[model samples]
Target chain A: MDAFQAIADPSRREILRLLSRDTMTINALADNFDMSRPAVSKHIKALDSAGLISIQNIGKERYCILNQEGFDELQEWIDYFDTFWKSKLKKLEMLLNEKAGK
Target chain B: MNRDIVHRWQFRQSPEIVWEHLTKPELLSQWLMANDIKPEVGHKFRFTTNPLLKFGFDGIVYCEVLEVDPPKRLSYSWKGGPGNGKIALDSLVTWTLTLKDGGTELLLEHTGFSGMKNYFGYLMMKNGWGSKIRKRLGALLAGPGK
Candidate 1:
């Protein structure tokens, strides 16, 4: 699942909301949600796959922390063109300026 | 994320000169990439560039002129990708030249960045996600991640 699909769910977005503030274990995270532990786990797993969170094993407990990887793909697409269009236009401007100068 | 890219520039040159630079393949290669672009509508062409492996694009943009109005407006279908000629980005590129008081006004709009399958769900994620999510994560990310 991509970031958008992962975030489409309110529960998963809540999970992201919680993780962004503090790193928490599955049990602690499940306690905040009214859903079944396994269901929350499924959501957590989806967030992990979407690169929204990173899971780490601290002893027997697994901790989930918010990550930026999820936003990279979406942000990068726009940023690429942002730079590309600006630079390409700059080049075009220079071409016109040079021709007029001559 | 970005729905479209729009750029407008003022040039002392005339619209006719700007139109030539836009439609002529040889002049186009100077500003854009090397391509066999013709002003005629329905003409097919492609721009050759280095492969952008990170973005899943081979860097060559295949195009077809959808509309043409000399010295006024032009549009084309832009499609490209790699692997058996798969199309990753299928978009519309448009250019408009309007005569201004002193010279020509060039406008470019490159749209349709949301159609990619993996990014399709994001159409709602833009407005639906809203400022709530950003407000929640902004402080956290700004604190340590910056």
Candidate 2:
């Protein structure tokens, strides 16, 4: 599943929000939801497949935390034009500087 | 994600100089893509860049001026995708220029990234902007990425 599909579900997005604050065990994450444990597991698998969250095993528990790989591109895309204008304006500054010198 | 992009820059030039760079088609093509932009409300323009046939992008951004306040603000509609006449992403790009302490400050806001299918194009747009800003403008300034 892609990052877009991973975020399509509200439950998955909630999981991401919770994990962003702090790492949560699979059971802890599942407890926060109103669905079955298997259903929650299904969502986690989808998130895992999308590389949005990472599951780590410590002793008997699997902890899920937010992954940087998730939505990095999305965030970049959202901020793309902002950067574009900055660069464009910077070039404008150079042209203005040349005009001032002459 | 909010999907809204806002950025601001300060240049040591008057609003008129910066405004010319924004509204003049020739100056815009030097910095942005090739376009026949005019400084008037309701003017239609198109920006052409390197074609991305594989990603369904014809590298053409069709635009129409929505607002024009000379030496102050300019807004336009941006739509780009495959040349099939189908709009891949429909968004608005606004530019605001303000005179400051013998200089000008420019603010840009691009919004309206709706739905999931457009996300891919959005990602490509991000890379395209990043590269252009970092590469082309950086080359002109000689030290932007630093």
Candidate 3:
């Protein structure tokens, strides 16, 4: 999934907002949400997969922090235009339809 | 580290028909922006769009024809923004068309986003890049153990 899809969820966005403030263990991060630990873990996994967060095993516990490098790769203007093109191309499709009708 | 954005679409039109939309300046503007586009290599062109000066978008894009394979491929440099001895946005847009069963398959690859500076310049185009991603970047700047 793209970074947008990863953060599309409100809960995941909240998790990112929390991580933006400071690094926290998975358990601590889970406590902020009113959901199952496993659900929170799933969200973290999604963020980690999308390069939105970094998970480090600090001895017995795993810590999660916002991945700075991941954000760098995603902030490209093209990322926004990726969506823009989708819409623009749809308009192109419509124009093609009009031309075909004529 | 390549941040190219690729968008693919399958249209119900022949590659030859789609080629016109990609090559003809008037047809191209219907979907993209107004331009003096020509289908010859090394040809220079300027794409003009609605002005959004507040975001640093002077409604102009400087371009040059890079590659042209009529009905199959087209590539060009895409650059714009305040030019004051510093290049704000510089990239390439390549369009590839493939003949399909009943229509054409189009692929757009826009590449060359290298560093943090370019990233911001891109956001400042029309969308509030600062409001959208700055929180995350700001956090990265103030990251723990940094």
Candidate 4:
């Protein structure tokens, strides 16, 4: 699942917002949702599997925080395209310059 | 939005000349990649490069020109993957050129993701993160932990 898939739902987006400022325990995150806890958990699981968030256990609590993994997927795409196009365009610029010089 | 890449660049040249670099195969290969690209709409072409086997890509970005409006607008279908009919991404690449500042303003839009599924799969495979994704998927299927 990509970052887009992870945040594809309103609930998931809300969950991300809830965790955006700081890490929140699973229970704490669930209290904000109107849906059943299991449904909320399902969303959490989806987000987790999609690498949007990380679930870490501190003692008996499962804390959730925004993870860089999925965002990195997005960033990777942007970076690759940025580099790909810039390099090609640079070459084109040089080629055009050469033509102008000639 | 949603994985679409939009880029803009300025070229100190006429749209006619910039358009040539975009359409002519020899000129395109000098800047982009080796290909048999043409300005004709519906013309099929492929940009070939070194194979990236790790990503299951044969290094051939198959494309088909979709629209061409000489020196103004152009669009094409960009498809690639592990060959043999399997594709990781089925995207559209569109280019628009505007005459401004006595130069050409080139805009590129690569869209058609998020509406599809295989792109994430392709990226995951390309990044060699399949094992980690599988682990996460397993955890998801096992239901949430208490």
Candidate 5:
């Protein structure tokens, strides 16, 4: 699934939120939620496929860490919205000034 | 655990000019906010933004300069407000100025954000700092003046 789709679910978002702070092992992460280990593992897998999180083998355990590179696409999308509103507001302000003969 | 955001801008001015504007009260007020800054380490200051009055930190960035290397780097501690019952959420904001062929490259990093754990705080900080640095500061530096 895409990044947006993967983060749409609250469970997945929570997993990402936790990962954003620091890396955690699968068992440590599973302990935070009431879901079973398999369910948590599925959420982690979906996030991993989306390139939002990466798993690294540390000793015998695997740790999941946030990979912010995926958010660049999202940031670019938001930047467009920011530019659009800024220009639109500037045009509206100019129109209002002209009407007021300023 | 370095949860800091770094932003860089290349300005068409000398490092001294950029540094002056960054540290001077009048120039900083135009872009950053209104504050009484002495440009000395341990000097306390407060920045007030009218919009921040509602959420309580509009221009309420209480800070103290930690280090100042002229035309190069400046580091300061950024606190939220009065030190009574406040959680003392402090961050280190450092600015490094490098002389470039065209002009000067200003690099800013806001680190040590251990207290911004909540979603709303994080969102507000992301939007607020991004706008101030990318837009307002850019406009000020691009304006006709040293």
Candidate 6:
């Protein structure tokens, strides 16, 4: 799953939000949602595929942890827009200065 | 999971000059803070505010270079501190420069923020880094102190 697909479903986003606070076992997370274990597991699989979450087997139970490194790609995309605004603001600053000089 | 913030600026100088100021320790100290910065990857640096005014950064702003592409991009990790002793959150910051007709366009991005840690850290960086840092230090760069 890509970034867009991972964030499309509210359930997946909620799961990510929960994991961000702390790692949790599959059963622990299933307790929060009304869905069944299989449904929650499916959501976890999608998140893992998207690189948004990671799973580790701790003896008998598996725990899910949030992974933030994937968001760097998204950040790189957003930086382009930021460059645009800075140029615009600079133009405005110059225009104001020119008018004030008159 | 990662909360990213981007900030940008337009400097009244060429990309070369802005790049120089950004990389050079002395020039950076003029606008950023008084500290030493070795111009190499994995090199560490510190930025300190004036002790008299005591209104600047609470502690040394520690940074490590992650990437450096001249006249285009520079990325680093930044960590600040509280005056008392506790170190603040660590975040990745990147600065990009593009040559424009009038001047150089500066882009700053800070990411890798985990959730809300403290009230002050949230407030200070909630906006982007370029705008916030420029508002505080742009005038100095535009003027003659350095």
The lDDT of each candidate is 0.77, 0.73, 0.75, 0.74, 0.63, 0.63
Residue A43 displacement in candidate 5 (angstroms): 31
Better of 1 and 3 by lDDT: 1
lDDT of 1 by residue, B1-146 (tens): 34567889888889999999999999999998999998888899999889876666778888999999998999999887654676656678999999998699999898765434334334335435345446643432232123
Model 3 preserves the real interface contacts to a fraction of: 0.37
Name model 3 segments beyond 4 Å from true.
A1-76, B52-55, B115-146
Interface RMSD of 1: 6.0
How many angstroms is residue B119 displaced in model 6 relative to the true structure, after the best TM-score fit?
Answer: 14
Model 2's DockQ?
A: 0.15
Give the TM-score (vs. native) of candidate 3. Answer: 0.57
Q: lDDT per residue, candidate 5, A1-102, as tens digits?
A: 655467557788778667755689999999999999999999999999887789999999999987765544323323432453344334433443354464
Pairs in steric clash, model 2: none
Off by over 4 Å in 6: A1-102, B1-3, B50-58, B83-86, B115-146
Q: After superposition, how far is residue B97 of candidate 2 from its true place, in Å?
A: 1.2
- lDDT tens readout by residue for model 6, B1-146: 22456666666667877787778877666555677876678998876754321111365667898888887888888765444544434567788899987778888776654222332223334423244333432332232222
DockQ of each: 0.24, 0.15, 0.16, 0.12, 0.03, 0.02
Instruction: Output the lDDT of residue A61, model 4.
Output: 99
TM-score, A chain, model 2:
0.71
Tell me which of candidates 4 and 6 scores higher on TM-score. Answer: 4
lDDT string for model 5 (B1-146, tens) is: 22445666666667887787668887666555688876788888877655332222333677899888898998888776323435324567788999998577878776655332333234334434333323322321231232
Superior by lDDT: candidate 2 or candidate 4: 4
Best by lDDT: 1
Off by over 4 Å in 2: A1-76, B52-55, B115-146
- Give the alpha carbon lDDT tens digit for every residue of A61-94 in model 3: 9999888766654344555657878888998999
TM-score of 1: 0.66
Show the lowest summed lDDT stretch of 10 residues, model 1 chain A.
A69-78
**What is the i-RMS of every prediction?**
6.0, 13.8, 9.5, 9.1, 15.4, 16.3
